[model samples]
Target chain A: MSGRSRSRQSSSVRISDEQITDLVHKLQQLLPEIRNRHSDKVSAAKVLQETCNYIRSLHREVDDLSERLSELLATSDTAQAAIIRSLLTQ
Target chain B: MANSKSAITLLNSTSSRLCFARTSATFASAPPDQLKRQSRRIKMAAYSSMARVAGRRRAWARALLFRLHTRPRHKTLMRRKRRPSTSSDDMVGKLRRLLPGGETMDVCTLLEETANYIHCLSTQVKVMKAISNHHLSKVN
Candidate 1:
């Protein structure tokens, strides 16, 4: 029974390893920063680091845009506010 | 409703901390649980969007702010740590620096978290883009 369970565990680990490789491939494709680099040499960790940096920049961009939107809405007249409110709800 | 309220809260928070570092030593670290919660928040956001409900898209925004707020306190602690080992181990160390709460994770868990993080980030970008496009069209 123990031997059988061990084999099963090993197979599960192998499956997960394959899944990780697939995920790494997907991540590599999504990141334009890493796309120009030699695929054979770039490591998964490097891809992850690039991805983290990309996400951080995107987060910052979103924050900036949201603040600007709020400012525009705040300064605009009621009609503009009504339009945006409608747009958001739709 | 709750979604717009969270967006307002996100706007009300510290304006911007847009530092982009590629290989900086002063990377921030977070507990693994928080990372999991961030992923959960993203899932909630996705579910709401799919259901055509006004969802709290600001969860990731708040998380980003939280990371920036917490960055300074962990710098020295992060730099001081050492784990000397194989080449793959060095790669793991780099990943630990990259992912939030990655410092304590095993390789499997790290990969899982990375997947979730990537998905959340893409969703965030999409949501933000949609919002921006909506507003820009209205103003123009």
Candidate 2:
């Protein structure tokens, strides 16, 4: 189990733009179902639940973006530091 | 005139000292509960003011983001208008000439833009959390 876990950790998965597009398309399709689910008989509790779910999803997106942003910032910072060090040394 | 001015200064200083003493005495004699309530009120006021400032900053950031988003579109429009007769190849040359520092500047600009976008996103997240908290507090 440890070896299998190590192998999985070693492999990095890259998500393609096409995959994102497909996921977006699937989400768009799912929207109507969500709308239909609460269309006719919308209760306050249901609306609140839906809103909470929506907010949670947004929070997740923000968290993901923040993580990516931090990674990019770190990479750029390191590169910039290396460049500055090299220039100073020279 | 000097005598009148000196008298005026003396009167002003005495009045100010009297007012300060009155205020301090009142504050010192106030009940503990009243003091606590006053402090709470002050704290609440400060918090609300901070929230208002944050909201204003978020609005400013959103406006900046809107400008950033539209800037490229505006640039393209201007490019089309300015060089209707120019070929695509010429456009590249023109852009290179227009942007003085070339690739390094472009990379720096891209990094700055990304940083601004991240700042905007983080501000939005903070605003969202505040809104959710406000809603929850209201419900409770």
Q: DockQ winner among the candidates?
A: 1
iRMSD per prediction, in order: 12.5, 24.5
Summarize candidate 1's per-residue lDDT along B1-140 as a digit string, tens digits: 86455443332221111101101112234345443333333333332232222212323233334453455642421133555645644655766665555665556556655555555545545554554465567667
Worst 10 residues of 1 chain B by lDDT: B14-23
Candidate 1: the clashing residue pairs are none
TM-score, second chain, candidate 2 = 0.27
Measured by TM-score, the strongest candidate is 1
What docking grade does candidate 1 earn? incorrect
Question: Among all windows of ten consecutive residues in candidate 2 chain B, which has the lowest summed lDDT?
Answer: B99-108
Q: What is the C-alpha lDDT profile of model 2 across B36-65, one tens digit per residue? A: 333333222222322233333332233333
